[model samples]
Target: MSTMGRAGQAPMVVVDGVRKAFHGVTVLDGISFEVAAGDVVAFIGSSGSGKTTLLRCIDLLEPIDAGRIVVAGEAMGWHQQPDGRWVRDSERELARKRQHLSMVAQGFHLFSHMTALENVMEGPLTVKRLPLPRARQLAQELLAKVGLADKAHARPSKLSGGQQQRVAIARALAMGPEVMLFDEPTSALDPELAGEVLATMRQLAAEGHTMLVVTHELAFAREVADVVLMFHEGRIVEQGPPQEIFTRPAHEATRRFLARVTGGVPQPTGSS
Candidate 1:
């Protein structure tokens, strides 16, 4: 399967001929797409359709069996050498590359012992080498941005699932990433909590963050995504603007998937 991605003013991510297999089971086969700067690309498909695995591959958490992923003009996990051969990039180099793209997984994954402010501060302090006072200030600002300034002193154990997820987002933003990747970030949350997380993500999209989200929320995808990719059997079967993809899907599998997710009632396309 192949897809020629829509053109953007600046292509922030380029994924080409990517393939991945797990213990002899293929999850992604020749996946290709481009995410432009400040664009939100939503990946939607049924369970086991390889949505999350694709995100993991882009983040370099899963080694691809073939092909390449490039973000912000830097190839992930591999580097082209002087002799024009691709070599596995050093661990240190890969770490540097990851700093450009932050990921939020399904779980909040905050440090249980640390307060929300401290959890957000840890990244800046440990990774970016900011001093305690500076990191504290920065953390507070990020929490405020996520509408969690008042919850700064609250521990993850004390916060609701929604608030903890927001804190996790703040922590990711603390690293000053050029792109953000979300792997079913709200899947573990209840409906109310998911709404809060979606609100946070909506705000991020409005603020011009480049995002690649794997989500089951068709509503959010229709409302916030500039582009939506419909995956099936380890390949993106259809992709286009939200309106075209949702209201006028080109593939039979996509129509069936939307029918299942939206309960035969798809919301009107364009803007939240």
Candidate 2:
């Protein structure tokens, strides 16, 4: 795949021909996509479609077996040194590049022992290396941002699933990422609780935060995504603005998948 950087555009995140596998099975097959500054893109697909794998590849949690990933304008790939050490090309460069990105996963992954406030502060204190007092203050502010100020002292076990997920989001924001990747952030919550998390996401969208979300929440995607991508069998079968793809999908696989997901027949085009 060819790589080019456009002038007069802020570098966000790029995945080019990224391929990943586990054991003998290929999960992501030469996937390529770009997320622009302040754009909210949603990935929608049935199970085993590699949506989650693509998310992991972007975050470097799962290394791609082939292809390149560039985030915030820095390229990344492996290099072998003369001493036989397999080194990551531009490790320092990647570190600096990653400061612009943050990720939230399906599981809340909160610290069991720490209060919600401490969980939010941990990233700033460890990653940003801010002083303890400053981190605590910033954590409180972020918790309030997520509407969890009153629950600051609550532990993960004490908070509802939605509240815990909000704290997880607050933790991600503490790292000061320019773009956030959410992997099914509301999947584990009940419907009402999930609405709470979605509301927080909507607020972030209104603030113009660049975000890419992997989710099965079709309603949320229809409501908030600027662009929606439909994945099937390790490839993107369809993508477009939410209205076009959801209301007038051009691909049969997309229509079938949507039918299964929404539990209704795909609506005929131009139907009222």
Instruction: Highest lDDT: give the candidate number.
Output: 1
The pairs that clash in candidate 2 are none
TM-score quality measure for candidate 2: 0.89
Q: Model 1 Cα displacement at 265 (Å)?
A: 3.7
For residues 46-152, write the lDDT of model 2, one tens digit per residue: 98999999887777667789887777766655555799886675766456556667888899999999999999998888878999999999999999999999999
Runs with alpha carbons beyond 4 Å of true place in candidate 1: 1-8, 266-272
State the lDDT at 215 in candidate 2: 90
Q: Which sections of candidate 2 miss by over 4 Å?
A: 1-7, 77-97, 265-272
**lDDT per residue, candidate 1, 119-208, as tens digits?**
999989998899899999999999999999999999899999999999999999999999999989999999999999999999999999
- State every prediction's TM-score relative to the real structure: 0.94, 0.89
Counted clashes in each candidate structure: 0, 0
Question: Which candidate should be chosen as best, given TM-score against the real structure?
Answer: 1
lDDT of each: 0.90, 0.85
